[model samples]
Target: MAAVSLVSVSTVKPLGDRVFIKVNAAEEKTAGGLYLPDNAQEKPQVGEVVAVGDGKYKDDGNRVAMDVKVGDKVLYSKYAGTDIKLGTDEYILLSEKDILAVVS
Candidate 1:
């Protein structure tokens, strides 16, 4: 399968319960529909689901269920993830908890 590289980091085999996401670029327009100039536009906290790791841990030694899978568009908290670099590209690896919701 073809995969996009983020942060120039080679394919990261995430540990259990972790996920990889590639942030989507922010829109230039404001919430009020006012289009902000490039200099005034703020960054967006969005990303595309890239890869998923194994399920979460269970007290019984079983894996807990996972809600999101690859290719899911999700909203995350600002500064909620850890950043890594890959060949000049950037990507984030965050716990599933950090993901607020999966965008419809």
Candidate 2:
């Protein structure tokens, strides 16, 4: 029998000034607070940091500090960013400047 290969891991490695984010889809609620169908729910405009890129470069040749780290909740603009597929998961690789705000 031929050998079978199984893989399981994260291949996303963000470069400098970039971040790999996994947007969280919004939840649905019915009139009585019940769960609504997936198609009825709207797309999510919020997300959490799955991975953060390295620090950016400053004018003085020093690496600027990264404000956000892994597992940070954030809010982003709707209809922004491009989608990519890594392995079996979907992610968005966008510049830090495009990030709207960091949720506390």
Best by TM-score: 1
Worst lDDT 10-window in candidate 1: 1-10
TM-score of every candidate relative to the true structure: 0.73, 0.69
Query: Which run of 10 residues does model 2 get worst, by summed lDDT?
Result: 1-10
Q: Whole-model lDDT, candidate 2?
A: 0.72
Mind sharing the TM-score for model 2? Answer: 0.69
Among these predictions, the greatest lDDT belongs to 1
What would the per-residue lDDT of candidate 2 be over residues 1-104, giving only the tens digit for each residue?
A: 11213422265677888877876756778678999888788767677888777878998999987888889887776666666654555566677877889998
RMSD (CA, angstroms), candidate 2: 6.1
